[model samples]
Target: MKTGKRYSEAAKLIEKTKTYDLEEAVALVKKTASAKFDETIEAHFRLGVDGRHADQQVRGAVVLPHGTGKTVKVLVFAKGNKVDEALAAGADYAGGDELVPKIQNEGWLDFDVVVATPDMMGVVGRLGRVLGPKGLMPNPKAGTVTMDVTKAINDIKAGKIEYRLDKSNIIHVPIGKASFTEEQLTDNFQTLIDAVVKAKPAAAKGQYIKSLVVASTMGPGVKLNVTKY
Candidate 1:
């Protein structure tokens, strides 16, 4: 696919606007979204890094300001005390070994995220074939595997979106839909950007945030001027 000049321009702004506060950043982002563009704006985050560097690993979650514009079914892997916590925290599916067979047999990926407690990895482990290919595996490096069942479940229900750098060392995440107001999208966009920036590993060097673009589904990407942040 050909990357447009708009994408490159938006990327420049993303680099420039990195230092702005949430309030100021949102205001500027709104302006970018409202401006006339040569293409439609699909909401996506693009980050570039050198995947060869282990320290370049990027992981974290962010609650989109306007949600993901799609329903997210949350699946939690937990046992013992954490099971109740996960359920009470709003997990759609929270169980043990029994879920393994069901998930594997069904090969389900109806849920957008999978969270597992430290002890529950064993259960989730068996279903890797089912979930791994779908990108739903709960890996600790991605903050999906944790002992805090309640926090994990709640965050997912609250629209927490997680992303990791691909083989190309680029991470892309959806923040909202084209129908969302610019203000709402901007808020969600900034929140995710901040989280990703902070997730940079201390061992990582060079430019952690190579570029950023905010666009819509099947739309042209708008580069964010991020110098202020």
Candidate 2:
């Protein structure tokens, strides 16, 4: 793949062999971002666990103190009064049966997050194959499936994020935007790091956090010294 001129230039600024401390890595990522629009800063973690084992799965959610610097369009699956409650709480779309068909037939999935009430899980279950692969399925563990529709919608809009290891035992989370101050980004980074550390599975052995890297949307990745976190 051919690298763009901006990307090539950004790559030169990073030391390929050196792992930087959290603050230095965050500052470097912001400095290297040259995108015309506000670029997102993301943290990628490589965990020393087998993802295939059910006991070793690492998954949870957290609300970033500084938020994700993006508006989250939320869809709520609920019936009757709950629907109105969700919308009043700032949900982008709120419905029950009507939504399932639209998503299944028209394939209408324009929202960023999906929330469902416990009673609506039967309906939500039918769309699992559709929403599951997209990571849009409402799961209880992620707090997306619950009776408190209003609280869930508000939290999600407030930058609550779900993190889970992929097939490669790696989890990628957006800490904040490159436009955020180094201090703001650092706080978000620390919050996520603490959460991931606390979520370590008992089945996980060896180094829990194998490696970590932080980068802007269009910038080269800056490796972080895991021990410092």
* Candidate models: Cα lDDT each: 0.67, 0.92
lDDT at 18 for candidate 2?
Answer: 98
| Cα misplacement distance, residue 228 of candidate 1 (Å) | 4.9
- TM-score list, all predictions: 0.74, 0.97
Q: Give candidate 2's error at residue 44 in angstroms.
A: 0.2
Tens-place lDDT digits, model 1, residues 43-130: 3444455657777667666766567666778888878878788888888878788787677787656677888888888878888777
In terms of TM-score, the best-performing candidate is 2
List the lowest-lDDT window of 10 residues for candidate 2: 1-10
lDDT at position 203, candidate 2: 95
Judge candidate 2 at residue 170 and give its lDDT: 98
Q: Largest lDDT belongs to which candidate?
A: 2
**What TM-score does structure 2 among the candidates reach?**
0.97
Superposed Cα deviation of residue 18, candidate 2 (Å): 0.3
Quote model 1's TM-score: 0.74
Worst 10 residues of 1 by lDDT: 34-43
